[model samples]
Target chain A: MVNPRLMVWLKGLAAAAVLTVALGGTPSFAQSGEETAHATDAVEHEAGVHDEKGLPQLNTKTFASQIFWLAITFGTLYVLVAKVGLPRVGAVLDAREAKISGDLDKATQLKAETDAIVAAYEKAVAEARAGAHKLLNETAVTADAAAAKRIADVVAGLAVKQKEAEARIEGQKQTALANVRAVAAEAAAAAVAKLAGVEPDQAGVDGAVDAALKERA
Target chain B: MATDPLHQFRIEQIVPLHLAGHDVSFTNSSVYMVVAAVLITALLTVGTASRALVPGRLQSVAELLYEFVSGMVRDNAGAEARPYFPLVFSVFAFVLFGNMIGMIPGTFTFTSHIIVTFALAATVFVFVTVLALIRHGMHFFSFFFPSGAPIVLAPILIPIEIISYLMRPVSLSIRLFANMMAGHTMLKVFAGFTITMIGALGAVGWLAGAVPVAINVALVGFEIMVAFLQAYVFTILTCLYIRDAIELH
Candidate 1:
């Protein structure tokens, strides 16, 4: 990220360097070079000869004071940091860490609880579906048994009715046959008497009718 | 006023006092050191005043600085340096704050001075030396000679090791002081060009002056980065030194 800025700065410095060289060369290019040289010499002289003591950093006079103040300030800063500042910052950081961990723990516990609830809910739904399936199967079986029993009862009633009707028809048919036999006997006796102009015996006529009926059976 | 690049490094006595025959007068350097200390203290103290679980902006910055130095100590110095965390933290905060504060125009850069950086480095060197001596007793001297090397190579390697060991504070101090002084001096020189150009050339000087200004602008950005880098270098070196003392490596 800073590379581009550095590049721009380098570019600017290069441009500036070129410009400085061009401008610096101007003094020699013009006739006023001697005057500028004198001014430059004057500036250098004053700068070098100002105190003649060299750099102030080399000055031994201020060393004691600087050291004295440094000891005091640095010592005080160390004490303040070690005793007051660091401990408090450390405490805040520790507290924040503890709070974050606590929140995370709580979240984990809640998630576990949610997972358990989901598991229980799923189990209940499964059990209910199984129960419904069992109940549906049981009802279907019971309904089937009831319908089978009803159909069996209806078939038995119809069979009994058919047997009774057949018995009644057989009885009527026997009664009608008896009546015909009796009428046939009476008519034969009457017809024999009328044709011979003499009385015919009932027993012989009955005997003849019986013999015919036996042959037909 | 003379546009001397070195002019900015000059220390002026803010309050003059003679202490027991010593010229221990409070100066601008002292003032800035005190400011740096106070600022570090305030950033740590006031920023964490709320002790909020969720930090505010100032608290976040304070925490970031705290963790940055803490991680530096932990990574470089190891767990044995845990007890000395405050010392490492203080040095880091002091140097970092001093360098950053110096980036402001016309501000006194205390870290740019040899005496100040030398004093800081010397403190670290002394502390590490004492710690090693106390922990290892006479065995601390074994640091000068590798155990696997032949006795014939001891003469060659021992002196070299000793010189390098002794140069620790010097190198440490000079690296920070030189970096800061050089960067600030370079910026000042470039800034001086603007004034010099205007002085040498009349109305047309403004257009030409833009060149040095542009250079100074870019240099200022670079110097800010250097300031951060130097502080990190100084603190990490201190941590490394501490690690060496503790581990005897």
Candidate 2:
């Protein structure tokens, strides 16, 4: 569609230019010089009339001149825009995009590094906690063993003292009983001798004493 | 007829000035150009500054102008020329407004003059050529020679190509100038006829005058279309030229 429009425009321009040239130019020399001059004068007169009416009279020379100047103006403007303005705008946009991308990359790298550091720190802390807990448990078990050993030693020492005390009490009781029996027997013999008054036979006295002693035992 | 339309083209001082022993006449053309410049500035600034999501009428018009030219450049020259949007847009607006504004009762259509149109055309021509040169370097000269042509045809084909290429600015400038001048002139002639006919005949003259008046009305509509079309054509050609420069085919 755009191509067609351009073609149409170019066609129109060509036709208009051709018309202007044909109208402006001198007629062919095949015609007499007089006819040529008359044709030229007629064209000039027509041009004058056109000028008075403020119409563009077809003139190739003027047309060519106009084209020359138009080209100059358009060329200058194009250079200014294409070379100067466009490059500046492109550069600014590029710089902005680069800045944004660079910042994003930096942020990503920093975040990764930070995460790694945090992981390392957390691992160290967990290891230290585990070590401390293990040490506490071992100390508690050792302390319990030591306390039990001390209590066992105290009970054994008490048992040995109790056994020695029992043996001493039994020996004292036995010696006291023996001494009391000796005293009673001597008293009995003296009493028996005083009551009897007569000199009895030694055998009878001995047999009676043996009988009394046997009965008392 | 004015001795010189170029002479008529002057930048007049709004304030009187005595500069280097010259008596300068402050003309209507200068005042209008200034007014046009100011008008363009105010319009674009005010229209775009609001930057509304749902554009107001004025802003929409501004946006439409921007989109239209940008679209043209994109479509005609391809996306690579997107960077040239502003330049293309500026040319469109300036020429479009300049042509339309001249249609007002008493305004000078600078575009009607050959010099102004030629200036615009020549600028496009030079830029396109320069672009081709810059992009292709010495190989840019190949553009004047047709591809896949026999060596025997070079003599005929090369001259034709060269002439056609050289004629671009001429065609571009004249197309605009001739259209605008002819359209305006026709309108003026018809308007003059309508008035003169009405004055000559009493009641009947009004009936006769209606012919030219109706024609003039139709011409007005046509001229409006032409004004816009001419501006569009000018910009589109510029884009094509730029495309050729960049692509060098």
DockQ score of each predicted structure, in the order shown: 0.31, 0.03
lDDT of 1 by residue, B105-171 (tens): 9789999988899999999999999999998999999998867778997787787677668877877
Cα error of candidate 1 at position B119, Å: 1.2
Q: Which stretches of candidate 1 lie over 4 Å from their true place?
A: A1-52, A180-217, B52-54
Collision pairs in model 1: none
lDDT of 2: 0.66
Per-model TM-score (chain A alone) = 0.57, 0.52
True contacts kept of each: 0.69, 0.06
What's the TM-score, to 2 decimals, of chain B in model 2?
0.88
Cα misplacement distance, residue A61 of candidate 2 (Å): 15
lDDT of 2 by residue, B1-249 (tens): 222332232222344433343323233433454455545555555665555545678666755665577679989998988766767765776678778987786676767766667777876788788878878999998987767778887897777677678888888888887788778877877877777787899788899999999998999999999999999999998899888888876
Candidate 1 versus the native: TM-score?
A: 0.80
Report the interface RMSD that candidate 1 achieves against the true structure, in angstroms. Answer: 7.4
Give each model's whole-structure lDDT: 0.84, 0.66
Q: Please write out the lDDT profile of model 1 over residues A44-66, one tens digit for every residue.
A: 33212223234667556678888
